[model samples]
Target chain A: MDLQHIRQDFPLLRDNKIVYFDSACQSLRSQSVIDKIVEYYTDYPACGGRSMHKLAARVTEEVDAARATIAKFLNAKKKEEIIFTRNTTEGINLIANSLGFKSGDIVVTSDKEHNSNLIPWQVLAEKLGIKHLIVKSLPDNTFDLAAFETLLKKNKVKLVSIVQTSNLDGVTNPIEQIINVAHQHQALVSIDAAQSAPHEKIDVQKLDADFVVFSGHKMLGPSGTGILYGKQKLLDNLQPFLVGGDTVASSTYTEHEFLPVPEKFEAGLQDYAGIIGLAEAVRYLQKVGLEKIAQQEEELNEYLTTELLKLPKVKILGPEDAKQRGGIVSFYVEKVDVHQIALMLSEQGIMVRSGQHCVHSWFNAHQLKGSVRVSFYFYNTKEEVDRFVRELKKIMNVLL
Target chain B: MFCFIALIVFAILGIFSASHRALAKEAFQCVFRRVTLRACNTGFKEKMQAKILGKLINRSSRVAKFVSHRFELLAWIFFILSIVSTVWVAKGVYDFYVYGNCNGLNSTGFCAFDPKGNNSAVSTISTRPCSLKPPTESDLTLKNVNVSLFPTKNTQAKNKVVLIGCYLCDYTRKAYPLIKKFVTENNVQYTFAHYPTKSASSYLTAYVDCAYQQNKDKFWEWNDKMFASSKEDLFKPEYVQSLLGKEGYDVGKIKACVNSQATKTLVNKQIDQLVGTGVYGTPTLFINGKAFVGPKPYRVYQFGLKPFLFF
Candidate 1:
């Protein structure tokens, strides 16, 4: 890939000098995505799916096109399976609230799941009396498929909700194998692809995950946009999490007929501009190619990991092999505070995420403070990584 | 420890900038946590230190390392210095209020509150070819000066205020009203010995002596009018004669005495007595033997007269 040409598509990268390593938190938007959002606001600023005016018709058409684009991006069987939500958290919350779990129903998650995936199950267990099981990771912080299978065999799990890729360690789970095993147990499988969908191509039909959720902002899309894809049958079976306005087909006093599948799940006034921008983001990602993006990230991660390991007291969080860790290199110094390291890096205009990164359960279980996480995207350059390393070394010299 | 210093610095800076006000609020929270014996979990100190060290590391890693290691120690040193400077400023403000000059009574050092040193300014003694080295506050004395020979009021009163000044000098004009009011209110013995530093105004000193010899109370009234009148008006003989006549003084007889050799001898004797006191400037007052040489604020003269002034 021509990195300079790609960087020109992003206004911040084109205009300023900054090393951005916080893509795991939120990716920067491309100029096309920004233009698409502005177009929605400036050209056809009207209600979608409700009005019959030309502006409304244009909005409805654009929103439908966006849903189709997201469906194509995830390789979903049908466009009807794709539901729009605010973000990954909202998608997971919708599933947790509408999945019809009764008392003693079992739901399983991995130990390293982001709170977006973990906390919904916790609230379910608290309020609905469902059993929430946590499958622990191996010593190297990689997914333990055998242990996950054993848990499935022990419990008649209703749903196996797990992160497709761990945000904490950048380790992709064997989600296909996990779904196959969960199918044998007659349990539905939901995948949290918040960290995976941005870099890797997710074929929902091939994985056969009952539900797949990911955020838009993590893939160069608008911040308040996300996708929740499920089989048409599963989405039809699940009750709507929120019900009002466009969610209904007809309503009279106390009686109402709900809309089908995705419309029923998406309630209230939607973020039309964000949805349009998200489609543009998917188109841009497709043009760039996910495989190339993944390859670029891995190459950058390998160099970063090698340089970081050269320093004393620095410990990478995931597997030692950079290939296994994908684009993320989350680590902690032996005695230094992670915030201090992150803040010092930020002072040098190298933005990285610090603290537990919403994986507080894992960090607390391990009896450790949070680690500094450097998550690379395809736009990042080798020189930026070198600058990050240089500044980190200077910080370590003083801190240690 | 650093939060205490940050709180003071940012709180003062907060007055002029909104951004610093936000930091000041954070510093206050950090300091409150420290005072409550809890760890300062605000991370404000870390944020500030990282910003400082980040700038330093860009230039020199060795210097950054040095500063980081002793950051708390350096904070303590700065904290102590801030406290010392704050106390010094407070003392200056107090001295300026009570003594008119920030450095204390009669000091000529620079005061930020009084940048021009106006409170301590004097119509300086004009240099002459035969004059000795300029007289200082230390050289000012009341000994060997005969105050009994000059105009005296309230002779039995224990407190004495002797003012040796030129009627035409600006500094004396500025101070005379305040001192006259102070002596009258406090019932102190007051003495006025006129010594003209200007040769053009020397003839008026003989007329003042003659007027005092005629009517002592009327002489004081005439003296007040002389200091209050404009310097240009005082140069006209008709204006002086009219002012003396208005004060109910016999202007014709006073003018006659002004030309007499006897009146000149008395004026010369009084100037010699004033000079014997080592007075060197206009508006020099001897309040119970302590000499002050400036147009001081009313409070400073009161402070000089009373030991416990507020009481």
Candidate 2:
């Protein structure tokens, strides 16, 4: 696919001439996605599933279509197994709520996990009597499968959740290895694919994950839209965290009975416009091709990372080979302020993210300040990388 | 030379100020001369003071309107801060109404929603009015009643019925459903009064009398129709019966009632007694010389009407 054609679809980049390098945090929207969101509101303005009107029926059908599309994209066993959620954080909380942990029941996760994955488990461990143990990541900041297995040997471990890719280091975790060992020990494994899914293709059936969560915003979709894919039987066992109008089959002043899984999980009005926009986003990505997007991003990251290393006093963290990683390239200039660098780049029309990237646990574990992340996507060109490098070099000199 | 320069500067400033004052004076004087010269010639007093008062207003406005037009951050911050303080003051106004000890020491007037002062603690001290003994059948006390609790025309019928029945007219609340059902059962001519409700037409008066037509239900129909025909002409006793047939009422029954007018007099006397007992508005109910008035909750109505259930 033509990168120019893909770039044209995003008016933000074209008009501002912005080189967006923060797709990890939030992806740029394609015109198709924007039009779909706007069209859904302005043209057909429907209250989904609320009325017997043509608009409501059509909207309800659209929501179902999105569910099916997302489920098929994730390669889940069934669409019913997929629950629409506000975001990945909510999905994690949903699973955490349902796990029904006892005081001695243990859940294993890695240090490289995002706070979305980490905090729910941590809160659960404290609030419930459950024990949450973190498996130390390897020296390269990748998942240490052996260490995870050793922890799993405790036999009290009932659940294992891994960030399929580290937001901090950008090293892809060995989900295939972890899932194998986890299943051997009769533990249900979950993968937080927030970073991995948009850049790479994910087959949950192939990975054998009991549940997987990833956000729409990270995948060039609108915010407040996310998917929680769970195994049907396990999801059936799991209780929903929030209970409300849609979730209940019937309610009275006295007692209430909950409906089946996905509906029970999604309470309140679903972000109908966001979900519609997200489906278009997914279709746009699919059209460009996820494999091709992955390939192009690797090329950009490799060239960018290689150029970044040539600068003095800059130390690159994570895997050196871009092929092993997603599009993210995080690094810190020895004597530079990350925020200032981000600002400087932003002024140059190069959008990069600075901060802990919301992976505070990894930062705390490694004992390092936040670094600047220059993430590339399929639409980003090599020339944009060259300009970014030049800007970075200038910013470093100014910092010194 | 320096003193000379200072003098020159001050002279220039004074000249400019004085000239501006003269120009403004001349402009106003010109307008006043054009519009009010003849009036002043007639010796009108108020217009003369306006010019004098206008100076003070203009001076104060100069200071108050300073930087106000610019909408700068400093002005905005101060204005917003003052507005927030106003809401805070308004929110705290409940302090003036509470007798003995105020129960709002901890009330935030926010969703943190402390209904009884304390966040989680139940109050030992009562937070309501002292309970008074309701009038019994044997002792019907006509204490001052407030009748302003009925629904206005805009309120839904069910809500109006429920509201009037459940609260203010607690003494005669049973009369509402009884009168309403009776009107429907009797096929009494009545329509809910929508607008211009104060003009007391003779037709409306006849309807009220008819509602008291040994049939409790006609009273509701009478009240509904009377308040609805709110024209001053309709209030005249001479044409009141004639106006009754205007809104599709039985003119003959109304006219005959008016010709005798005994029932109308009784209804009027009852209304006067209700008003005398301080039954100022809608839903004022007089039962056995007892006055029940004012809006109350649904539970209050259910409880208040309990004694009159069998009656």
Candidate 3:
């Protein structure tokens, strides 16, 4: 891939001199995606599925096209399986509320799940009296498949919701194996692919997970757009979490008939502009290829990790191997505050995420304050990493 | 400690910017927590320190290290300095309100509130070319100065205001009306001692002395008319005589008194008495034995008369 050209696609990287290493939180949108969003407001600004005018018909067609494109991006069985959500949190909440878990049902999750994945199950336990069991990771913070399988076997687990890639450490779990094992116990598997879907290729059909959810903003799309891909039969079986104007086919004062699958799940006026922009983002990613993106990220992460390790008292989170940790390198000095490092770096126009990063449960469990997480995307260059390292070293020299 | 400084700095900055207002709000929260004896968990101090150290570290690591170690001490120093400056500014405002000059009464120092030093300006008595030295405020005195010979009013009133002024001096013109109105309203003993700072106005001084000898009450009315008259009109002898006539004074007799050698000698003696008091400027008023050498505000004269007036 032409890395310089890819960087030029993002106006923030092209126009401004900044090293953005917070892609895990939210990736910068490309020019194409921005243009697509602007196109919706300027050209055909109308409500879809409700109006019968030319603009409305055009909007409905464009929205359908975006859904089809996203369906293809996730490799879902069909377009009907893709449900539009505001973000991963909304997607997780929809499933948590719609799955209809009864009392004493068991739900298994991983230890290092993001709050989006972790909190829903916790709420489920509190509300429905379901058992929320956590499968602890290995010492290196890699997912322990054996512990997960044992938990599935011990408890008659109704559902297994886990984060495929942890925002805390950039550690990718073995979802294929976990999903297969969960299926053996007849437990429904839900994968929080918010971190994975942006940096890696995701084939939901190949993985055969019952549900896969991810955010659009983490993949260079506009914010407030996400997707929940489920098996056709499973989505048809679940109740709609939110029901409003567009979710129903025909309604009277007494009773109402719900729309099929995706439409029934999506309620109210949707973020049409964001959905159109997200589809453009998916197309942009496909053009660049996720494999190349992942490759570039790994190289950048390796260089950053090697340089960070040279500093005294620097302790990296997760596996020491950069490849295992993907594009992220979260670390902290022995005595220095992580916020200081992040803020100091930020003053120099280097953006990195600090604090618990919404993985407070994991940080609190480890009795750690949190780490400075630098996540690289394909647009990030080695020179940016060099600048980050030099700044980090200067801070360390003074602080130590 | 840092939040205290941040609160003040950002609050001032907040007046002009919305982003700084948000930071000011955050600093207020941090300060509230600190005052209640809780930890400043808002991280405002660390955030600000990191921002400062971040810039410092790029320039010199040694300086950054020094600052990092002494951050709390530096915050305390800044907090105390801000407080000191705030109090100092408040005092200046108070002084400006009460004394018409930020530095206090009779101070010719630069005052930001009265930038032109208008409150402390005086119509200087042109020094004698043969005199060896210039007169200072220390030389100013009321000793052996017989003020009874000048035009006097309300002689039985307790508080005394003695004004040494000229008819043509602008500073004296600016002060005379305010002083006349204040003394009239407050029922204070007032003495107008005419010292002809301008040589051209020497005849008016003799004319005033003669007018006082003729009719004491009408003499005050003539004095007020003379001060209110234009500078060009005061220069004209006919206009001066016309004002004395308007005040029902015997203009013909006053003119004879103005030309008489006796009136001239008395005027000279009164001038000598003013010189003995080391009077260096016109509109210099001795209020209750205190020498105020400028066109002070009415409140300042009131304050001079009643030191505990505000209380």
lDDT of each: 0.89, 0.65, 0.90
Model 2, stretches more than 4 Å misplaced?
Answer: B1-311
As a TM-score, model 1 comes out at 0.93
Which CAPRI quality tier does the interface of model 2 achieve? Answer: incorrect
Top candidate on TM-score is 3
Candidate 3 runs further than 4 Å off: B58-62, B127-134
Clashes of each: 0, 8, 0
DockQ of each: 0.66, 0.01, 0.68
Candidate 2 Cα deviation (angstroms), residue A306: 1.2
Q: Stretches of candidate 1 above 4 Å error? A: B127-135, B138-146, B154-164, B176-188, B193-197, B259-280, B285-293, B299-311
The count of backbone overlaps in candidate 3 is 0
Clashing pairs in 1: none
Instruction: Please provide TM-scores, in order, for all candidate models, with all chains considered together.
Output: 0.93, 0.56, 0.96
DockQ of 1: 0.66
> Per-residue error at A91 for model 1, in Å?
1.3
RMSD in order of candidates:
2.6, 26.9, 1.8
Rank by DockQ (best first): 3, 1, 2
- Tens digits of per-residue lDDT, candidate 1, A1-400, equal 9999999999989855788999999999999999999999999999999899999999999999999999999888888999999999999998999889999999999999899988899888899899999999999998889999999999999999999888898998999999999999999999999999999999988888899999999999999999999899988988999999889999999899999988998899999999999999999999999999999999999999999999999999989899998899999999888888998898889999999999999999999889999999999999999999998988999877
* Highest DockQ against the true fold, candidate: 3
Kindly list the per-residue Cα lDDT of model 1 for residues B1-311, writing each as its tens digit.
98999999999999999999999999999999999999999889988888788888889889999989999999999999999999999989978877788887777899999899888887765521245676667878889888887888789999999998887878888888898888888978999887776776777878777888999877887888888899999888899999988888888898898999998788878877777787777888889998877888888888888858756
Instruction: Check candidate 2 and list the clashing pairs.
Output: B147-B281, B168-B294, B179-B217, B201-B234, B202-B240, B203-B240, B211-B218, B211-B219
